[model samples]
Target: MVIYFTNQTGNTTDASVSSFTSIPVLDYTQALSPTTKPKFLAQLRDALINVGFLYLQNPPVSVATQDALTQKGFELFRQPLEKKLEIEMVNSPHFLGYSRLGAEITALKSDHREQFDFATELPAPGPDEPLYRNICGPNQWPDETAIPGFRQATEEYLSEVDALSASFTALIAESLDLPPTAMDGVFDEPQQHKLKLIKYPLPPSDQTSDGAGFQGVGAHKDSGFLTFLLQATPHRGLEVQNKAGEWVSAPPLPNTFVVNIGRALEALTGGVCTATTHRVSLRQEYFIDADGKPLGPRYSFPVFQGVSMDLSAENITLVVPDHIRDLVKDDKVKSDAEATFNKMFKTSIGEGTLVARVTSHQDVGQRWYPDILAKALQGQKDFVSKQ
Candidate 1:
């Protein structure tokens, strides 16, 4: 199926397979400026309420900083296989570390990407702590001897991303007409912030030339609060699914980060803001390099932002603004935030995160926490049965 995407500039581009009509590309600099704040907020509100995904141009980080980090990331990934495998993700109980190509699954299919997942450098929880606490621990790192500047560069970049994420979160709250600190509690202490350095190679030669085939990541929704994605390649393959189920290409643009809402945000706002589904796939046309050689690989940095594991501890209540609430009152939206919270608040944030991870990483789930995975899967069945 040929899909047409009309960008913010009204320029239409055609894709051989499914794609969206358009996705918003907003100015992050304007959103942060006091003089342009109101207009920026309005545009952001509209994008969130309608599309759930946006390209944030001119993010707070500097080009030099980004370049340095990207270099370090490339260095880490280019290390000898023996060196890179030292901190394999399977070795960690918290599921933080390296995952080789085809190691992680999406929708039951293996994703053709390799990545290193890092989180906040927090210590292990006490034995008396909750099960979710087990998910928070020190990140696995490569030896400084092998990759000289990798750790420092990554940690610095993570700090910048966290700050940028917080700024966006504030803007998101303001867009909803809520207090700037409204969602602060979710990120107070021991916050769950994950950074992944991912690389996607060209699909197998025998695969169809048509865009219908999956090349890298599969179609999936983010499970946390928000995501900040930095693409290092020129190929366009990140696709966002619209309400009509059509996928829209979100090609990589220089100096911009792709930001999107996640399930937690959707549940919090009663779906007033979208938590759209998206995926990654490199098409055949982008398979060759500038010199006509097979494309080396595609790299991306994605940060997954999550709230405190005990999000239900305070019995958080969401009072959606009348104006916004009325827009999605009908069942046009997939899940009603208020209704969902009223019914599933007990295990929403923590269990939701667990279910998302376990379902996606079958090997990790089976090896690490089989009991918890079993309970979570059963809970999923119960939830589905009710629906």
Candidate 2:
């Protein structure tokens, strides 16, 4: 019933929200040299504090890299349905791989009319962590004969992206006032993270059905720390919700990665950097352009940069005020936060499910820490001599 993509009624611009307003573009281009580093950092710090997202231009990657990846991507997406399905998303445990149209459940009431996913190539882990034996595993892809140069281009694009993401992580740490060592122990030793190359293709006009992309993608907040989106050159549909609960068009900016802070940042900061809601806006088929003809579908590519899931959320105890903590203790605030987070990943919270995550709609917070830390310390001390 609720239209999530483009808000039904409200202001639609960068200043949509009262708290998380759109920030000025931070020109980090001068970060290349040692002398201008301070100036670059100042701009970055201001942007992060005011808005969790930024438009990154002149990033580490070159223009040639973008063009190459975009070309190879088109080839892969245009492959026959059977070939595309060879390494389908349904088969990937972590939801990594090529997906078909209507594969997303964005609206809750209906599936979105588009498909996108991620890929990662981490190295094999040593015995220190067996759970991640497959963290640096192979990416399953359709045979190259069907889509020539697909494998090579994709791998190259992924490598460049990985390096770029790491660079941004270090810079973000600097912005947060933490020593660069702050990133230690958080990422998997082998450094594996989810990286997607999205493609929102054109939709059909004559007929509409389960596959029509009108509801192309669902509305949701990002789940990780930061997302670096290399937008489609001709993109138009991306939208972000502002503080006032209104939707504003975030059309792709050329030569800029639409960067956004995600839930991990919010958790680490104890809610300082709010996880903003965003989704791809699907223009109806009947919607006409200024030319008096129906407009075609738009495209966008988002790469969600992240650390290992096994790591604990960052401790932002110092950032939040005592009053917010009190608000977090209230029944409504606690329940709502937990439920909202649970729904983001489609996990459960109620009783009787296999995992307690779904069932415990109640808030879990620092208030429970005193009692928990007391028992934990006793257990540690009691076990010290047994060894």
Q: After superposition, how far is residue 178 of candidate 1 from its true place, in Å?
A: 1.1
Give the runs in model 1 whose Cα sits over 4 Å from its true position: 1-20, 208-211, 289-293, 334-344, 374-387
Model 1: ten consecutive residues of lowest lDDT:
13-22
Compare the candidates by lDDT and give the number of the best one: 1
lDDT of 2 by residue, 1-387 (tens): 001122334433332134433434555566767887777665565455445566776777777877777777766667778777777765543344665665544433333444435466644445585332332455667687776776676667667777877777777666666565555544555555555555555544543454323545666777666787777555466666665555556655557677888765555545544566776755553244556675444545667665454543232223434443343323432344444444433421111111111111111111222343355446556786686
All candidates: TM-score: 0.89, 0.69
Q: Report backbone clashes per prediction.
A: 4, 11
What TM-score, to 2 decimals, does candidate 1 have? 0.89
Residue-level lDDT of model 1, residues 80-192, one tens digit each, is: 88888899887887788888889887765788899999987889879998766767889899999887878888888888888888888999999889997788876648466
Overall lDDT per candidate, in order of appearance: 0.77, 0.54
